[model samples]
Target: MKSLKLDYLKSLKWADYLFFALVEPRRLSGKIADAASKPLGGGIAIALCAVFSDILAASLLAVNTRFFYYKITYGFLLLSIIAFVKVLVTAGLIDMLCQFMGYPGAVRTMIVLILYSLFPQMFLLPLAYVFKVISFAPPFFYVLFSIALFVWSALIVITGISETHSVPFSKASLMFIFPYAFITLTGFLASLLALASVFGYFASI
Candidate 1:
């Protein structure tokens, strides 16, 4: 047990550990790119699915309230479950991407990326709750979080594309936003179109 603990400490010092922690989305994107022959639609679908799933999971968990009301668990259970679902979906998405992109060891990479990316958002949740500022908190927080993940993912993909893909991090970050921007725009347009169609149908009725 002592040796195991020592080894664990030693492993923490490795650069790969830091790399995986700081830039996990890149690793995830690599996996996704590898998995799908055509990544754009599949990537968007996977992301949207994960986001909706997380929202649903959080909503259901929030409704339980037993621990919050009686046991006085202080948000531990809620935060824990939220983190678990986030990590699960993140890992699954990464694995699917890697498989699509034709990368080797997609499953292993997904596990590593998920483990590394797990805790940051958990930390964010309590901070947000404590601050109690939804106006300044929710919208930009998730947008920036998604952007950061996508930036890392894009960096990994670009780096993998060429030995000399040496764009600055800021530029790469902007590029990463492209997919998300498109997704947002398209989603908005689709919603508008759907609303129009519904209103038109009602008018005819």
Candidate 2:
């Protein structure tokens, strides 16, 4: 029983993973790649924790006068389901992009790496509360802090992709960005086309 407990404790080194993911991402990426064949429970747990932090931060920001337990509970459940789906879809998109870029990687590896990259986002919850406590804290500072966290997470994911795909960091970075860039460009062009169609119809009238 004692041995089992020790092993269990050793297995839950998520804290260390989070630390290294933020500070030593390239090294942590190698470790994550090595453990990619293991059960996905740990990676899922990390993703859930990161997602919960984001939800909790938004909940804190939404609190105006009173704190309602049921609202948070229901919101968490609904948002968690949405977030999980988004992660899976994103992993698929990223994997497809990687393959298109000639750096084919496993979907499972992408999922694990993405989840580990989110480790830095877990701090957003506490930072939100801190900003809330300080009445004079500027909104600019909060925005900067949020942007910094996102950039940090992006770098970690980029590094993981480079390590796992055995590709140049530049290529990995482009691979990491291609999906979102493509989506944004598509959306922009679609909006412009819709606007032009509307104008053409009005002109015909």
Candidate 3:
């Protein structure tokens, strides 16, 4: 455990990683991919911090509500667990897709890139607190900013994939989006089938 902690601390160059991720994701991804011998300590740390920031930001929005304490406690735990699982699963799926496409990149590298991409979400906590204290802009500011942050992260991931796989930005975007699009379509079709079966049963009854 002590040795593991040392390794994690040594690899946790959070400032440099965050800077490169913001300005030059392609370069950052390359660095991460090259460091294959290192443990995934940096990636795991960043992912945890990012999830915590997002959950805390969301909880801050409920400050005026009676459930603020509840959200701060159990909501953070549940949401953090979900976010952690989502990061791992999504990384696995993306790496599998890359392998099937003949890229054969490491799943660990994918996880690192994905976690770095989520660095923008860390800003949400400050933004939420600022808005809560000032209310300078309209409510739509939150929606717009949220969408912008999402796009920022997506672009980072796309760029990272392009850098890792030596593909064009357009192809990289397709690679990043394909898994999610397929999942959404599958879920939609399944829901439609479920509804149809229910209606058929009601009609028979």
Best by lDDT: 3
If ranked by TM-score, best first, what sequence of candidates would result?
Answer: 3, 2, 1
User: What does candidate 2's lDDT look like per residue over 10-87, in tens digits?
Assistant: 887655666778788887777766773543666677777777787666666664444546546776677667767867
Q: Give the TM-score of candidate 1.
A: 0.38
The global C-alpha lDDT for each of the candidates, from Candidate 1 onward, is 0.45, 0.75, 0.78
Candidate 3 all-Cα RMSD = 2.6
Question: What lDDT does model 2 reach?
Answer: 0.75
The number of clashing residue pairs in each candidate reads: 17, 0, 0
> Candidate 3: where is the Cα deviation over 4 Å?
1-14
lDDT of 1 by residue, 137-175 (tens): 554555565456545544543333221123455543443
* Top TM-score prediction, candidate number: 3
The deviation in Å at residue 53 for candidate 1 is 16
C-alpha lDDT of candidate 3 relative to the true structure: 0.78
